[model samples]
Target: MYIIQDKRFYVCLVVACAAVFAAIILIPNWNRLERGHGASPRVLTIGPDFTRKSLAGHLVLVEGVAPHEGIEDIVSGRGTHREIALSGNLALGYRTDETWLKVEMERADFRRRNLFLWMQPSVLDHVRVYLVERHGLDAPRITEIGQIGDNDPDYLWNGVGSYLILEYKEPVSQYYDLYFNIGSTSSILLSGHIGTVEQFNNRMYASDLTVGFYISFLMTVSFIFVVLFFRSFSKNALYFALFSFMYAVNIMIPARMYELLPVAVDMNVMDIVNVQSLILLHIAGALFFRQYFELWITNEGLNSLSLWLCAMLLAMAIGAGLGGWQAIMPIELGVVAIALWLYFFEYVRQFLSGRKLSRAGLLGTGLYSVEVSTYHLILIGAVAPDGPSLSIIYLANALFILLFTLGLIEEAAVQERRNRLSLNLRLARRAEQTAVRLAREMTRELEEAKVAAEKALETERRAQAEQLRFVDVISHQLLTPVAVIKSSVASLRRSVGEAGGDDAMRLQRIETAVRRLRETIDVSLVRSRISSVGGRARKRKVVLVTELQKIVERSCRLFPSRDVTLEFDNLDLSARANIDVEMLGIAIGNLIDNALKFSDREEPVAVTVSRDGDELSIAVRDRGIGVPVDEIPKVKERYYRGSNAASYFGTGLGLDIVNQVALAHGGRLEVENAPVGGLVARLAIVGEFDPG
Candidate 1:
């Protein structure tokens, strides 16, 4: 059932059925068919309008060397030769002894016409034809028609095989004795045809077309296999190409196409090429099928056996050539025929066992095995009667080529489809593996990020708690000492009431030092709170001038010896805006304090409020030692002291805090050297303004 499903199975079945039917039809009357030309009589009579006649049963074969004299010696029985009657064409196997054929041709009621004699399988090494004319009581007129291997320019060639022009233009006798002396190292076949020149030419033309078409088909298939080999790099394709090309050349020898070659080919060399080409064809076919079916994998023993057989056959071919043992040809054909059947059955076994084998391969090899076996049987005289016609031979070859090529194409397509599916499956698996790996890596990275965020949040909570404790220590413990020192200095001033200059100055210095200490503590505590985690600006509506004036009064009270001046320009002093009041006050106070600490007592600290578009600028100018030009960029970094301000008694937190406040209010702080030779720090804030 599995084999029946394949279309090629039916095709092969049809061919087999046809062959069986033909055998059935011919087997019953094989004796009648075997007696070709109705059992050729003792004399072949050529009638008027005679197209062709076979010199079959009329021929008498003689072995060994005949007398060099004319046909008279043979006719008179004076030569050392034994005559044997032939029932059909001369099918003498390979022989080293010289042989001669004698036949009598009679013209009956036929007009004078040019008659020609045609001989087949032109591989004969030497041939001589002698025509003898006899009239009653007249001296026999003997003439040698043609000779092969004598290099005679007058020899007739029909373009298909050997021939001789009998030249019967004016026939003086109705009967003639034709003597043929033939010798060859190759198997000799003397199937002869006698016809007019027109008939001979017609047969030649037909033979030419058939053989030409077969050779052309072989050549085309060879070219196609060559292309396929290069495109796919398949060993089977290369082997098949070689097989096709060698087969084409092999057929040319039997068809006498070699005579058309530009240079004359010697019979010896042609024989060698013929034998070697057959061997090569066998080897190539074996290799092609071995690779096609993967026999090495499926049946290693059979594959090795095939290789050994091929090697043995190659060695035997060489020995046959060297020893001139032409008899080995039939053995070689038998061996190849057996091997073909073996491989065909192997394919059949695989197919029947449910293995994925190409049905076309089975069909092609089966048909091809039958064709080769039948052809070999015919050549070796195993077939009843003589060999089939040349047309039948050509048709068999054509059928083999067509079916074999179809099988190869089908197998190639199936293999390519299988390979493509395998490649796609591998690609899909690789893609799935890559996706799974990426997902795992992404999950790992996400888990790492989540853990890092939780750790950061815990660290922030601890830092905020520590900051609150530090602020508590500054407000209670640290500020208590400064307040006690201030109270003690006031009590001493009251106890030593209206004390003279030195004592009063000493007490006043103590009070000023205490007040400075408290201010430092307050600034440190405010910096801690403002820079703490989650610190953000809390905006409230307040009059601009009112806020600035309160900050200036506080700075002047803290530094009583330093003059602090507040000025407003380019805007209404009473304009109210939403800003962070506490943060802004702390920033302005630090700027004023820095101005008083860095400048001389005689120099006034100028605090000015101005407007530039929608921005509010609060600038503090002091004639103090300016920052180094190169160090100005680093001043805003936390705890960074400018190079020029190293001697100033202040922490680096002031300008840093001012910069942060400016950013929170959507503003910036600009620190630059004043044109009059001091540092001017300007705080610029952007806010919504309300007229007060």
Candidate 2:
């Protein structure tokens, strides 16, 4: 089957080529031979005959006559009639008595010839005419006007309607005009000059304008497709392509509109469309090349490029508005081309350095190269060569573009599939490594933590043993003082009843010493009571402020009242905290007592309770010699004291013990100088408190 089909393909190809050759050979050569041009110039024997209504939809024709006769008559010093008479020479040798309508001048002397050869009567059947005068424009004047009778080929308006007008024709003057009339339809002298009506009819109505529009539109759509298909490509290229295509289209707009509808032609519209497109073309080219190259120099290169392009575009628009079309096009195209070339050079360098030329790039680059090549060819056609077939070149370029683009898409899909498989494989390997490493680290961390915890437990056990031994030694040392006091108390009691005056005095002294010793023991017991309460940790609760306040009041009464005063600043009532009330109170009490001991009698110490967010603060500020700046940090350490305060009567343990109590209750003591020239011992408890 495959062999048979392959053989049939070659057979079909041969048949197709044969068919095309045969058709080409059979076609007539009338157009190629210029046979249509001299066919008697198709004279109008009489008038075109049709009503205006019947001619509404029919195509009319009018011929343009150059006023060559008028000029020739003047150069010969002949009158306008001399030019009118020269019409005989103007008549191409035809054996017809039917004279097509001819133009004669009324302003100049009608001595020799008619300067203008008017439109043929049959021209009204297929074309519309606008008369061209030598100088000043005027409406068409009536000469000989009538309709042809039916069945008369020599004078009939074949397609539609007809009208004739013979305006004043001046010789050697730039002040004559022409008119066009179809049945009742007619237009007078136009404001602008008519160059060549034949050229206008041939070129303006040509499909080239539409073809240009479609080319621009197709390029724009193709660029957009490129952007979508090649996601890896930068968005800037897509944008540039879009803008360039749009700019090109914009440039062709005026010509397109004029060709499609000649009624709306004007200088302003032409200027705007032409100038804007030129400016846009350059801007698009610059940006497209810049993005395509990835030529980022500065940190904000893209931003800078965008700004510059926008500014240039704006400047060009302004220039076009002020300078008009003639000045704008050259300037815009030149600047744009220069800027783009620079950008393209930079881009090429960058692209060559890092870009891995993929199948897509190959396709894109190939299409672009072809496009550039054809553009140059088009330039050649416009300048050096006159007969190059632009359509064939464009068609080839389009076909290559479409085919390569489709191939690029297919290549990208295959690449994406490979990437997905590779990515999945890498993920699997990474997952395996992660699982193994995580398990090993976790096991090592767990073993290390177990060993550290055991070491911590042993250390704590030793510390407890040391503490118990110290307590035992303290108890033993305390026993001797107790025994001595007991013996002295007994001797004093015995002597009180039996001795004389001297003996009584000794007894009284002994009794006084015993009583002081008893008081010392009781004070020690009170210290132990405070310590016990401080040491018993419990889950914290609200009412930290109230407990702090109570401690302040009690401590103030128990301390020396001579010079120091304890002033309790009210707390914020809304505050609350979680703490052991007893522990908190003892902590605050220790702080207050320490403050009063260090404070001078003349200035009252201030006890303030305040709350900030979720934390509570109690400040026991003393108007006394402040803690030395260097010793402030050490004051919170156990059994540590400020050098200045160490010489005072109180034990150095007061602040140390206070700190422990504070920590046990989830708080801390910070000692700093008060703004009022004293030490401010602030206890920060991390809980809500009502400082009211």
Candidate 3:
């Protein structure tokens, strides 16, 4: 089914092209048939009421060499003159030979009126008309009526064109012969009309209106395209604008628009301009289609070929301008024909391959191909029509422009739609990617949350275990002191019946045991307070020496027999510091207590307070058993008891509490063995102290 459809498309294309070719050949022949072939001479009778008459079938044409005596030699039959009846305009292609046309006219009545002879395509190189009055053939009197050439200053121009016109002022003879001598480097086409003054004026008015409108339309379209090109920078618009403008100029040159200029331009130069405009028109057309069809993408070969053809046309135009090569016209027409066919063929091939081609482009190209080829065929004398009619060519061009403009609009819309669809597709893909990324991120976050929850649960379990162990340690420490107190009290009661010395000793033992129990409770309370407050400290200004003196006095009273001595070196008794007083006092007392508990009763534990620079130091030195060197670092850890502390009734939190207090004050606790014996624990506080 698809094969059949494809074959049908090809068949339609072939049939359409064949029909156009057939019309191009048949139409001109049909026109020629309607205007009968000029085989016999027909005399035109000019009555007083005659307005106009075409000299087509009423003329006899003869081709010969230029005579030195001019029309006299032709009239006297001095040379061989082969004359034939001309059926239409003289289309003797590109001839330099002289051609003479004879028109026979007879006056019917004596109502004399001025008569005019008009000739078209005024680019003819030379033209001379002679009026011959035959008085019964007794040596016919020949008088030159008018002479005009392309370069002649006497050339006549009407508002319509640079066409040749000759005026006859007086009509004396009843029978007259009008002889036309014409020659050209370009195509020899002489279409003439004879009419009265009113008739000539009327024809001129109509021709002016038609030609004026055609030129105006072309210029207007060219200006519009020029504006569009600047606005959009579109190559299609630019080339089409050039094509329209050149075509307008091409038409105007033949219509004798140059005659309206202030400076009289030589017709030969205008002829060069005419040929150059045609060349430019073809070049612009090639470039316009190259862009319009997007041939650069669809077919690079055709694109390059179009550019090459344009370059050749440009060279030919330059040559025509420099040397006036009238032969370039036919060559230019041939190039345009080839370019049009190539473009059309490529478009059709692309269409059949299912590439989206513009329907308007196809129609425009088809119509243009037919009309332009027909026109070229007529210009080259391949058809019966001698030349293209102005009206037909102008209408064909206008329709082609309309169709091409429609094609441009259609292509623009299609491009816009494609761009929109592509943008939507890209957006959809981006959205899909974002969704996938979000899903992956969510999965990662959920995994991380699960791990964090597990870590929190494990930490809580370990904290609970530590709390239970702490409670057990506190209970064991309290029970030891309670047991000692119970034993000492029972011994005191038993010693009541003994001597006074024994009873005093037992009371002293009970007193020491009670103090130990109170100390243990105080240590637990300080630990709880420190834990609750964390790293925060409430500081106030106080005299450091005075605060240290109170701590020393309390320690002395607690261990009276241990001889805890308070000492200082260069002590500033009135110096004040911003410190937490109670915390500092507790830390200092813990150092003294630990010294007393770890050493012998007669060890003389010394407490020294001093200041150096910004640092305040309270050192407690004991002269007894010191800490093991290896276990020194671990002694300041909470609830950490040393191996040497087995025989002592002490909680392991004293040094740790002192360290915490030192850190809270932005200071440090230093513990080391004294040089003599035992350990020296220094509570160093660094702060701004006022000395008085």
Candidate 4:
């Protein structure tokens, strides 16, 4: 159940590791203690023309003397130096006091070539080389000599390897005696090989190439890890970047890389730096393994210890970088030993718990731990002579790292799968709840919509019935007036004919007025019903001008005192329409009635009729207060009137009726405010209403 989400676990892991590291540093070991020096020379024989085998194990024992015995006095054979019988290929151990080595090399063809001696200690601080010619084992004569050290102003050699030389001639000298004085701040490990010029040069070049390649490889790997860390925020990549950087630096110092540079470096500084870098490498490696294995949560105690070690190592490293005392390299080594032991312990715990992943990881890491242990012991000269070689340690590390990389990949895959499963379960629960809620909402909304639709249909049915009843009432009221007008017009026409020609025109006007009145009443009554009931106005050929003339006379007779003007245009062009002459007339009469109703009796009402192409239009204007600007848009709505017209004695259905009539006759009604004063209403009967 443990996951990367537990951040507190990681914090504790770091603190515990750092504290343990600090404790580790409190104990010093082999790095601070000094070793005894060699006192006598070990002699050697070399072949001619630079042909001598490597001295990997041959130069084990040699004569060694203390620092106070000067080279001049020693060559005079006065010092009481002793023979040092070294057991291995190199001298190992830390020593602050200077020690001298004496070697006598004789060759068959000494006159023909120069002899080269290659001594590499990697950490030596200073060295003095003196080559003396021995004539019949008599008092030695100084023929050639040189000195080099970490503090020397000039690098006598082109590379980091410490080399000395001796020369001989058949006449002057055939045998050479060599003396070298060496000392270092950290350790005085000495290893050497003697050969002619050709052999020494070949081996030195090869050594440089190998070291250079190794350092470059480590740097490249470190750079790659740093870039990976930045790209993905991968924790493993970050720790590995630290590990690779430290590993590179540790190797560089031991290889005497500082000697090859243009600047001189104090061996003391390099000594501390090497120790610190090594400790940091172990710390980074520990952190990487902890996270990579999921041990930070499962093995809480182990995680805490690892983190404590990391913090302490970091503190020690910073101090070393800033020139803190560094005589306690062995303490750091001791910490490294403890960390490695913890790594094994954690792996074993995981293994015992039946974790296959941990078990597989243990197989690789166990090999890795063995190699690390061997390396540390070798550094302090604790490893037996027949034990694993340095080359085997490097090989084991490369293989174990590859195996660890595989294990990390497997672990990541497992974690990712678990996360996806958790996410899917969460989404499923949300979807189930949303589905149930949406079903309920949809059902409720459908029921609400159905009830609303039924109510709307019932209201519409009642409104249609009311409109039919209203039309019937209006038709009944207009019938009696129509009949009375017809009767009166007939009586007047007959009387005028009998009385003579003088009353003939006036009688004809009476008849025309009566006919127009009947037409308007019929149109208004029939057109008020809904158009969908198949109700339509009766159409006839009616002259628009003649109808306008009749309406003006009727208005004059009805109002008696009000002045109404009739304007006719395009009359000569036969301005006629096959409209319900009565419906068209009613629409025009409604406009005039509205005009007269809203205006003062003193103001003249204008009724205008015109024609253009197949269209007939009647325009009426009144010099009264115009329709209010705010009410103009909705003035055509049924039972709607302007605020100004509210006190007038009339229903507000006139314009609405006219609007329906115009639509039934294939025309439109337009209302506007007159330019000079009152309101103008125009009824445009368009689209060939002319009767054949």
Candidate 5:
């Protein structure tokens, strides 16, 4: 539960998080590095005029051309000389002069074959090519092969890419001479591709696949952002969607998509298309990041700078649409430099302030910054430009969107915590307000409840004391008179002296009635005590055999007519029981009395004392008419005699007292008709009843 405080767990978590970030950053760069190793060029085999494949990069660059140099000048060898350079210096770093590429096709089949020179940098302004003879000594058999740009065209206008295309009409099976002069005012980093028409189609297919993949990814991301923007109306989502759309367009333009389609647009339109989309893409990406990272709040200075960059960039985009792209190009440099420095300044400051950017944000902004610098540097003839802008822009946009999603999630969690805290604060305030008032109210109610409970307890104690007083009064006032009455009757019977006469019979009846009255009084008092809530039955180790023997002797002395028997199982064995001996004896006496009274004659009431499980059971079975099954349950109610006992005299408290005594001893009273034809009343008293 205390995981955050555990040092080892915290260390492991930090390591795991660091490892995840490392993988995200490094793995992609590794792949990029791997892909930087391009395949070696395949030699152009002299077979079909059109090979239906891309012209692999076996470039023969013609370097060191003057700014005003012509294709004719190169073929004539009249001014600056040309040297053969391969196309391997991919950076094309620091180009100060106009350059030409002379590709030598040495073998046969020059018959009506048109080899197109394709360049990928879509912003090139001029390109030229010439078909001429080697050296006949004169002005050098110079035929201009149709021209376009300063990088000319004896090369026909393939009406395709922003590249040099020379369509030639001279042919032989031997070596020929070709000359090109390439010049561009816009970022003139050119790579040459000379291939036949079938090869051109192949190149288009491959280009479409790659560019189309990127375009699809961008569009999907754009659509997703659009949906998010509509749902949440978030500025970041809107900006990101714009960023995706603009970059996707910029990417498509360089792939010569206009040429691929049958739309007949002018070269100026394509140039405007190329220039404006990239500029807008730059603006969109910056605004997206600015909103994403909350530049306004984070750093107002950077935010102002971003506004300035956006304004200037927008102006440049507009200029590109007009004829002012060249004039604004320098301003483009200043804006870029300021933006880059300010971006990094804000970025680092945010870090030092403990507000580090999310990985996606850092990666996206950093990548886009690098890409923008790379393009502009290439534009200003600073560092050499390598790789394509499309990849960098696409990746940057993706990362920025990813960062936005992560940031939104973080914000949601923070908002939830704040909301929960606010709710808790409200609850605490309510509780604080109610505490004093509710406490006073509860104290008053509890005081009243305490007084009432004390009254109840006092009432219960008085009732119990009255019950004990009643029991004492009956024991002295009632049982003594019954005993005196029995003694007087016995005295008179002794005076009459031992025979069967009317006086003897009447005295015998009086003595019997007196004895019954005494027994009933004793049972009544015992029942009262047992029925009282405060009844306390003092329990101790009552040896079963001894208690049964005393009970049998008492019963015989009390009732001289009936033959009473206590058929105790063992007298010598260690048979012991824990019980309230006085209460248990009373219960047993009541049961035996019921048995004797219910019997027809002096048929012995079998009173058996024995151990049953953890209880001592004294069973009194009588051979009289057994109690009716229907009145059995009510027979245990105080003073409720049974239907079968209509002819017999009983207080009914007898069985009730036995039942209560048994329950007080944590046992029970069981009544059942015996198998032989009798009512058996069993007083089961639970104790440490051990029968060894």
Candidate 6:
């Protein structure tokens, strides 16, 4: 039979593998060049205290905070004052002291809500403030702690807000000390919650490095998981690599901007390079993902959509390049939103389809999704002038990026478990098949042995029946001759008294024949009984030469007047085999009787015993009339007589008896006419001969 190995499974495996690559590499890179479009950005604000006499009444500026964690001096000013300068710029890259203040005030709403606007303790339940300051001379430090006020308001729409304050005086002398009350608070007003210091730091890095690293790791892990999980789909390694390279480039752009903008660029333009890089990476990510997922993207449709997206991005890039970062912000957000929505819809649809999913696939998809949402919210907050949406977005980015990373780890674990299960299943199935095969073979062997045993039993039954039948024939032969001889002896005595000498002589001859017959019958009877019980054959091994010699000597003793000649011409027949000595003697006794009875007294009766190869042959030849061809075939049949030999005073069962005895010893009788005009009866018996 022929079998066709199908390739569809391989194809499906390839497709599934391609999906993971798209998520990890393609999406992250596409986000790089699309302004703030690809994945969202995060900004974290830590250690804020706003009160009547603390940070609430002061205008503060911060710079040179670490990528995710560190310390920076906060200035009480309207902008980036040299006195309070942090030796670095803010996230947006605008360096003028006055402009930064305007941006913060407008965005923080410090003018509308007084210094106590975010002093609500109820809504900002988790907020705690600490202040540590250094004095001159020995640089002694002082620490102050504050808690949110109890008399704060709460609202359903406005969940929480952040405002931090601190107070300090410039050093006059080495031993002078100055201090004031500082307040940091979250109001229960418009914009939502403020997270912890750790949470805020994570969100800031999320846009610059955290989100990028998470996505890149997911892409890398997913590719590896697919390669191992489905070895057959490993050919897609190149696609994943390409996507990863693009995502790496995107992440590098943002990370470089975050570091370099503070040192080399204006504060207002700090986000320009990162935002542009994100836009470019996003476009590339989308294209690669589409290809990897085998998404339905007609050339015409893709080209058209790409042209519009490219036009918008190019315009935004030009605006930022020309130092009109504020003017391009709206257009950038609008274009980015449309492009991102399309990608989101496409991915969601594909995921919903009955696609094969690996742990990496689901993880990457989920992380990418959260990143998209965060980007949107942050973009809105970054462009908004009066709300704390920027801070809120930064906090959310941190939460989402961490969540996505955790998801990736879990998915990897799941993939490992499933792979193990599949391997175990294969091993189990192989074991079952082997067991079934062994059982079938054992059953067949048992059946064959049973059949062989039955055949041997049937053979034994047939041999037993043949023995009983031979016994019955022997009984009749003995009884009939004994009765005739007894009658002849009684008649001979009476004739001698009544008739004359002639009558007495004839009766005497009959009496002699009867006596000889009685002796032969007695021997035959004993042989038959012993052979029937299987005793004679089990007693001793009969020698072919000795048995044949005894049979010829007995034949001469019974009929001494006959010319019986025992001839041996290099006929060294001495092989030992399992046989009954008595049975052999009786069978040879009968063959010799027939040969003597049929031959003329002057004719020679020859007996020869010899071995040829692995068998022993004993021949008794007589110079008497040979059997008629048609009657010869029936000579071994019990009670059968030849037409020419019917008048002879002899039972017709002698040769049949000889045949039965020969068969019991695994020998056979063959009768044929000699060239010299006589019947030659040969017994061919297999001796215990080893050819080797």
Residue-pair clashes per prediction, in order, are 0, 39, 0, 18, 21, 55
**Of candidates 2 and 1, the better by TM-score:** 1
Instruction: List TM-score per model, in order.
Output: 0.59, 0.31, 0.56, 0.54, 0.57, 0.33
**Per-residue lDDT of 1-692 in model 6, one digit per residue for the tens?**
22112334323433353344323222211221112211122222222342222122122233333233312232222333232221111122111211111101111212222112223211122223333334433443433333333222221111112222212222222221122221221111112123333443443444345455545664664455345435433223333334444444445543432444446544235346545545554554444344434423222333244444555566667667776553344335444444445444544554567545433444454455445544443333222212244444444434433443354346446645776788788888888888888888878887887788788877875776576567658767678768977886796587578665777778778777876677556545755565566542443655556666776787689787777777754445554555566666777777777887777878887877766765667789988878998788998887787777866766667887778767776789999878978899987766654333
Best model number under TM-score: 1
The residue pairs found clashing in candidate 3 are: none
lDDT of 1 at 8: 42
**Sequence-dependent TM-score of model 5:** 0.57
Q: Alpha carbon lDDT of residue 687, candidate 1?
A: 60
TM-score for candidate 3, please give it: 0.56
Runs off by more than 4 Å, candidate 2 = 1-409, 424-428, 465-536, 539-589, 596-621, 630-634, 646-653, 666-670, 674-677, 684-692
By the TM-score metric, which is better: model 1 or model 4? 1
Error of 6 at 675 (Å): 4.1
On a 0 to 100 scale, what is the lDDT of residue 520 in model 4? 58
- Model with the higher lDDT, candidate 1 or 5: 1
lDDT of 4 by residue, 1-692 (tens): 33233436545554465455444333332332223345433456554435654444334233445457677776776676655534344544545566666566665553555456555452456677777887775777784355666555443543522342232232246677666766543423455666656666776687577667767767877787677667556788788778878888887886777767899777668767777888778888878877765643366555555666677778777777776533345345555665666667666765666766555577677777777766545444444222134455666665566565555555555655766777787788788789778878887887787778777766875686677567668777878987887788788776666665757777777777766566555544645543434446676766656666776686578667888888777755445656675566556667777788789878888877777777767788888889887788898998798888777755677888788777877788888888888988888776364544
Q: What is the C-alpha lDDT of each candidate?
A: 0.71, 0.47, 0.73, 0.64, 0.62, 0.48
lDDT of 5 at 190: 47
Model 3 bad stretches (over 4 Å) = 1-40, 137-139, 159-162, 230-233, 256-264, 293-304, 342-357, 381-388, 417-692
Give a tens-digit lDDT track for model 5, residues 1-692. 11122334423433354344334322321211101222232244445444532222444455456667676666666785645434342233223246565544454454556555555442455655666655444455665565665223223343333434544454443545555555534434444555676676676676567567778878877787787777656677788788878877776665556666777657567657766887787788667656766632355544544565577678779877887664345345445644654465556566656764565555545655665655554444333232355455445545655665566546545655776899799899889879977998999899999889889988977887787778768676987678778778878877889887899888878876876677777765775666564456788886667776887778777678888766765334457777787787787878877887888775778887776467667788889888788887878887899777787766778888788788888888888888888898888777776546
- Encode model 3's per-residue lDDT on 1-692: one tens digit a residue: 12222333433443355445434333322222213344366788898678688776777876453565478787777776655676655555555456677888889987777888887642367788888988874998988888866666776667454467778754588888898877553543456788988888887898788789878988987888787667556788789889889988988987887768999687678878888888888888888877776642266555556666667788889989896555556555655666677678767777878877677788778767766766565554444332245445556677888887666655545655776788798899899899889988998998898889889877975785566458557856776767777776767667675557766686777777776787777787677666556656788988877887887898788777778778877776777888888788889889988888888887888888887877878899998689899998888998888898888888888999999999998889998998878999998887568655
Candidate 6 segments exceeding 4 Å error = 1-527, 539-547, 571-579, 596-603, 612-615, 623-656, 663-666, 675-677, 686-692
Quote the positional error of residue 675 for candidate 3 in Å. Answer: 78
Runs with alpha carbons beyond 4 Å of true place in candidate 4: 1-42, 48-67, 90-92, 155-174, 252-275, 322-326, 358-364, 383-388, 405-692
